[model samples]
Target: MVNWSLKAIDYEVYNGVTVGDLILVFAILFIAFLIAKIIAMSLRRSLADKMKKGEIEALVKFVYAVVMLTAIVTVTPILGLNLTGLLVAGGIAGIAIGFASQKVVSNLLSGLFLIAERPVKIGDQIIVGNVAGFVEDMKIMSTIIRTYDGLYVRIPNETLFTSNITNPAANSARRFDYTINVRYMDDAEKAIRIIKNVIEEHPFALKIPPPRVFVDSLGESGMSIVVNIWAPSSEWTDVKMDLLWKIKIELERNGIQIPTKRNLA
Candidate 1:
């Protein structure tokens, strides 16, 4: 019939942190989490029209992280954990942990650099090392990309920061080249004219840079005609797919044929 109360537990302390201290720490953490969520919601609502999704997300994440970190630091004294003594007591373990966390620190710094440098933004089509995709989001430790085939990939920020990044979409215009082979007997000049006409018909093709179609080389089976086209960076893929087959069809309509093994013979 003894009554148990929080006051009765206050005298009992383990490792300098009482049971009440643990409860208070948890309570503070829960409140901090709620505050962060509320702040994030408010930020999204206020910034929805003023910022892009990625920018808003980055801002919200940064704020939330700061709030959580502040909460942890504020409560550390209540937990009575002695960082100095712990480090001194476990010097070897500390070194091992530091070594293991090197990559994490590297990723964090790289992410910060990416945010500041902005070589590629969300929705940008980019090629990083062997990976090519549209940037989905930039997180604190990693970047998310949605590949052309719609597969999701997560790349460590450290890797992305160190890799060669190719962002064709960063420029207003993009160029793509194609090599079309015509049968040696067909008119290479007429083929070039047809290809040029096809490029001009496409809406996305740039007239300023001007398309180039010329006889590049003579292959064993045919004459190699190179077609270089400049198009709006945003529409280059559509322009490429639309114009390539059109050029082929128009050339065939005018009696020019792609060289095949049988055609070569």
Candidate 2:
């Protein structure tokens, strides 16, 4: 014969929670939260000291999310939550979120590649598409540019990856080419010699490669002479403008007449 009362007594177990145990569990969780916060702050300070400002910002945000997640996991068992079940749920949620944020993830990865490659850096002058500006800030999603007119432009990382980037200041030397049309009647050889001298005398011009002046072609209007000069990249624009003005002034001062519409006839 089966003893039902004896079987019931054997199966019974003490699994009930007490007030004191609950208090201890809560205290442990509180302490864990505080410790996580302290550790996160310390990590942030260390990373900030070694990394770029934009990189530090991203790293700090990641650390904060991780710290909060760890705290949540530490407290889950105390709250009687099944760890395995929670993990399964979390995995499914993460998959969904990842799919939805695919573009965001792509941009972030592209931005990281840009920073590592350093094709362009902060304060570099760049021309992307029709936009020309100095790089002000580089972030995970996009880059900020301050235009010459004081306008702020936000360009996505994806665009930068695909477009042609013109970095004028990438090298220390740059070339300036300009054409001057003078009357065929004037001494073309003398004019060429004079222009070469002017370029060589310029303070901004480079002497290594030397300046060049040659007759480009005989146009319908006049004789075309091309002037090519090399200078430091930093002085490119200023040198180009000043060279043009100086050439004009010197040519007129030397009685060298520039071709006009009336000369074309």
Candidate 3:
């Protein structure tokens, strides 16, 4: 509706930037931003299946920042600024800032590496440092973990990179173990057989690798019956909880006395 087109009005009221040049620069900057956005969208589409949504979004933002910064730096000369002087000053400033924020730069670089390597992704349950929970999102500076206690935790990217990250869900299946202590007087062989039967009947426990039921250790308190079984990673927690209860109940029915206290006498 309004006249948005510029008609070569030099209109040099200011010393450096004329009205026409300013308008032209604005137009170019807008066009450059639009192009950068397009490129970002394209990248997101291409990498959708290869990475998590949060990581992809982070990558797109990084691309947008780079493209826009390059565009602005490239177009500034067209708007009558001293090109050589600005570049030299920018270089010096960049170097000084780099020195000042080396740690920050390190974290940002580590974040990029994480996004590419994908040790853990959004919705993955992991324990890193003191934080243990499902990863909420990952950014250039830090990673957000939604803890099991319903708290949000943020860890720096550099620390995340260096720390040992235990991802319980990294594999398709996971193994769980339980040590059941029985009184020394109980039939150890019978207890082992009862535990093995319980494991064999568990609906979620995998059968390919087979379950293990063996006498793990003979402590002063009693004999420790070790039970190890594997199940789908998604059901690992539930399987352990329910399977332990079933094993205990089944052992008790078979007269295998699981020691509740140390018989020191």
Best by lDDT: 1
Predict model 3's lDDT versus the native.
0.84
Q: Rate the local accuracy (lDDT) of all candidates.
A: 0.86, 0.78, 0.84
By TM-score, how accurate is candidate 1? 0.69
lDDT of 1 by residue, 173-229 (tens): 999999998888998887887788888878888998988888999978888999899
lDDT of 2 at 158: 75
Question: Looking at candidate 1, what is the lDDT of residue 195?
Answer: 85
Residue pairs in collision within model 3 = none
lDDT, candidate 3, 162-213, per-residue tens: 9999999999999988989999888999998888888888789999688989
Candidate 1 worst ten-residue window by lDDT: 1-10
Q: What is the lDDT of residue 209 in candidate 3?
A: 80
TM-scores, all candidates, are 0.69, 0.68, 0.67
Between prediction 1 and prediction 3, the one with superior TM-score is 1
Indicate whether candidate 1 or candidate 2 has the larger TM-score: 1
